[model samples]
Target: MTKNITTTDFSAVKAADKAQSYLFDNFCELLTRVFMALEEEEWATQAAWDIAFGPSVSDADAAWRLVAFQAETVTAVQPLSVDDLLLHRMAGLMSRAVSATGIDALETVRSRAMHCIAQAPMATAAAVRDMAKEALSTIDQMLEHALVCDGDDMSVRALPLAA
Candidate 1:
């Protein structure tokens, strides 16, 4: 398949420069976990949020993360904010995931991803992958059945297409 390939510079990011966005609130944990599967040229921390959120933070999946800020009551997050790291990370992922499917399909996936929430981000990502595979399988089945039926002829084919 033709792909829109991109590359990244896996360099260290300054903590002060990085920022954060709470992706957890928007997407389900499973779909968000897809990041875990991403080759961590740098995505181990910040996702490609820079580009994804630049147009709008809403463009990201259900981001649930802490930023560099102190709360009135308490502060628990390590290093405060990860937005900088996530920014580049997300930008990279989008680059890789962008396909012949076009922006419309990506938008559809983005909308669906929001419903996914957090537990283990990596595992959640895997679950999202599986869900799409399952959906495509069903589509294949319907298409095969339709082909055999044709127009008003419900005759069974000698060869099994499903196999």
Candidate 2:
């Protein structure tokens, strides 16, 4: 079972805080850049990595964590393939991320997410009743990073559900 945060568990809290900081600082910026580069047809794997991780390249561990998060939240949603056009793949991924938020008007969401990646307060919180609440909660949660525990591992996870 996952342990709840307690004052005595300083290391766990510290790790969670560090993870949150990294997600806040780099994750959003990287997504914005990725979408922008895609729109311009100027995105390259190497270039994206350079731009996103260049400042902290010496921190190999941090870079790897960011890359793993990227894979989970970005590329894994809509992957580039040998036969796929760059623009389409990019749009697919962005759209998928937005849709995962359970928002209506997927095209509009996609357009906005791609064009305005850094916009915040992407979702509104409301009181939901019964089963609907359970469904909507998942959607709402997608917009922000959450520290999740799975067995012995803990990771910061988020999706492009944020504007």
Which candidate gets the maximum lDDT versus the true structure? 2
Model 2 Cα lDDT, one tens digit per residue, 41-134? 2222334543455433423224334433453443333312221122223333443544343334433434544443223223411211211222
Which candidate gets the maximum TM-score versus the true structure?
A: 2
What's the C-alpha lDDT at position 95 in model 2? Answer: 38
Cα lDDT listed for each candidate: 0.29, 0.34
Candidate 1 scores a C-alpha RMSD against the true structure in Å of 21.9
For model 1, the superposed segments whose C-alpha errors exceed 4 Å read 1-124, 151-163
TM-score of 2: 0.27
- TM-score of every candidate: 0.21, 0.27
